[model samples]
Target: MWPQEVLALSRRWLLVTLRERLNLLFSVLQPAVWLVFFAGAMGGAVDSRVVGTGDYIAFAVPGVIAFTVVGNGVTAAMPLLFDKETGYLDKLLSMPIRRSSLIVSRFVFQTVMNAAQVLVILLVALALGVRPASGAAGMLVILVATGLLTLALTAAAMALACAVPSHGTFFAITGFASLPLLFMSNAFVPLSAMPGWMEAVARVNPLTHAIEAMRLLVLHGWSGGVPASLGVLVLAASLLLVLGSWQFARQTAERIA
Candidate 1:
């Protein structure tokens, strides 16, 4: 019975997101523009040493994909915050069901939305000559990793939404937090190229593992040591979900009381 409520909540969120046709375009296009226009405009002159990969397109493609996922994942929290401020979330809590369902549904829908953007990015990458040697196996690994990483980020977003006072504050904080994670990561540049300190930071970034896992899928053939890459992402996401779920339930319960 509890499981059914969770499923229904998740389903309703999915439908609500689909109804917003413009969000569908804005999410995908924002990332695609960065992948195509920004990457193209600055392709030649900016050869940073961290970018060991000779082909500019190869260097940029994976990073673009990572950005798309993170961007979409974090922003998913906005709807919840928006609803609460609008009194919709309080109305939702009046129903006798597990609060976690309300949260899970948003995360589930977010992953779906991000997946749509990824498909477009991948097709554009193919058009630009970034081929995946892992073929079908590689793509499967990429999708699996992506799903995991996105969920993990979604948990962080949920936590942020719960704690923040306003949506603007949430947006500013999440954007500030996300941009650094992307920049300091091995996304655009090789770790070897960074100064010792920056390289060390990127080394520790969980996103680095996710990127390595993804690179193996698209660049290297599906390698044997996939677990290490996946473990970092899945572990981080699991911890965030646990922490966020606890906070969400506690906060919502107090509000209702």
Candidate 2:
């Protein structure tokens, strides 16, 4: 990959994200809002032991972070679709830069943006009387897991962007997929609390592994499950990165041809 081109494009997109102040504010706030309200509503009703945390807020914090990654990472391709519509993508295609740089830059931009959002959510969680049981070291593990999950989601979204004919269709597909994935995971509750079938689904869900990893860190410190969860994320991210890169390269070639 062309590192310079990737960095340049990543920086350009980051600036655009910053310029859209309202969108940026909402992106950060939405997760925080969900963490606060969702936790408050469920805290008293749900048993803390069932949720696998001291309180619902603590349990929901990682869930909120994971969902934020889903929300932002899945829409990471919107700008690419806009570029395609405006002929900017064609211009980039005509340039000497590596085609993979486009995908890399998108990954970089989404990862950074999600990181910032996660930071806000963590601060909000802290204010709500949550603390990471494993301290700063566990917090770092949470970030790493979150980053891998972001990479996988963003890569898959960009691959879909290349596959779909329009941005509207992309939105439709991702919108349909995100919420179901959230509900199927052990994000808000422990797997033991889920129905048999949903529990089975959650067992295999990549998002579940990521959230569980974060939950383990936040509520229980390091555990044996952390490696397995991180492994799942790493595998998913690697495979999706390859798929996305290939899809983008093929699309570029076809457009050029």
Candidate 3:
């Protein structure tokens, strides 16, 4: 079926990804820097009374991981866009593979890669004294929640890469997006301290849910913001991805002509 074709395409993408050493390194370093310098700079000041991590650092591990996966996922479709502009995608379409299969495969591969990157970040968090709040069960739940969120966001990002006109615009959008959202989310501080409006915004941010979910798994165990925030993340990512996919299909179809 198409799913099998998608998986096969993902395998091929992995091989191609291995050739892009700079992208791989930069992607790994970017998130690590955020967790180390940006996070450690705060010292012991980050709070998690509401978000779940005992302190800011622990609370941040998930957010940092989410940031990594998100950065990678949204940019995953960039190469395809470049290929299209350069005539590579046209040649690809001429191959034996089904047209939609190529797109689906790329999305699947990026989702898996994003998940892998987050795992590495999680390992680093363990080394940094950020142990899970609950036992194995909590860790599993957190993993599932994070994976779903990451996968959905990655799809949306890839969709943007497909629909956006140029690599310049894609990178610009990513830069503009990463910082403001991170700051606005509950990654660094509890929403409690913010003005009522900002607090409300943070409460609704998908990133906030991702952070809250991680906080529960790592710091507070089962009693954290598991239910509420996780729900928001899923719902929001789903909506965005649907919109992105629609846009991507429209653009790709135009290009195919």
Candidate 4:
């Protein structure tokens, strides 16, 4: 029953997203532009020696993939905010469906959307000469890592959506939080290049682990760090899912009451 409900909800959300053609284009375009323009300009100016790769684009591709997940994942709450504004959320909560399915379905949809965006970024990267050393296997690992990261971010977004009363407040909060998380991580630069204190923070950032793991997979094939990276992502995803589920339950209960 739960599986069916989740799937149905996810399908509905997916269709809504697909119907937004401009949004879909822009979602893909944002990362593609970064890959082509930003990466292109920086890839040429930066010495490969500093980045620890002969091709700076290759080094940056994984980071861009990580960035894509983070960028898209953070917006997972917008749908809920829209629903709430339109009174759709209250209507849905009034239904007999499993309340937890609301959270799960959003997570599932965002995970798939993030994966699609990552694929588009990777394809653009490949066209620009970025090649993963691990080949097909490495691609699979990248997908898994990105999916887990997306799931974690989506869960957090859903929790914030439930807790916040307005879309403006939610976007402000998420934007404030996401930028620091992205810049501090190994998304655009290596940890070694950062200041001592910043490097310390990056060491513990979940995004760092995800980026590092992806770097190892794409640039050098599977390494010892792969298991630890994936493990952290999986654990974070599980914990955030629970948190979001709890928030959804609470919010729904209040509405129903």
Q: Identify the leading candidate in terms of lDDT.
A: 2
Query: How many residue-pair clashes does candidate 1 contain?
Result: 1
- What are the per-model C-alpha RMSD values against the true structure? 2.1, 1.3, 2.8, 1.5
Candidate 3 or 2, higher TM-score: 2
lDDT of 3 by residue, 1-257 (tens): 77877888788888887899898777766676688777888756644455444456676777777767666666676777788779887787777767778777776777677666666676677778777778668767777776767657666777777767788888888778877777787666767767898888887778778877877777777863687777777888778777767776777677667
Q: How high is the CA lDDT of each candidate model?
A: 0.79, 0.86, 0.73, 0.84
lDDT of 1 by residue, 178-243 (tens): 999988887877777788999899877877878878876676666765778898888888888898
Measured on C-alpha atoms, candidate 1 has an lDDT of 0.79
If scored against the real structure, what TM-score would every candidate get? Answer: 0.90, 0.96, 0.85, 0.94
* Model 3 regions lying over 4 Å from their true place: 21-26, 29-33, 45-54
Candidate 2, poorest ten consecutive residues by summed lDDT: 47-56
Point to the candidate with the largest TM-score: 2
Worst 10 residues of 4 by lDDT: 66-75
Stretches of candidate 1 exceeding 4 Å from the true structure: 46-52
Residue-wise C-alpha lDDT for candidate 2, range 89-108, written one tens digit per residue: 99998998888888888888
In candidate 2, stretches whose alpha carbon ends up further than 4 angstroms from where it belongs are none
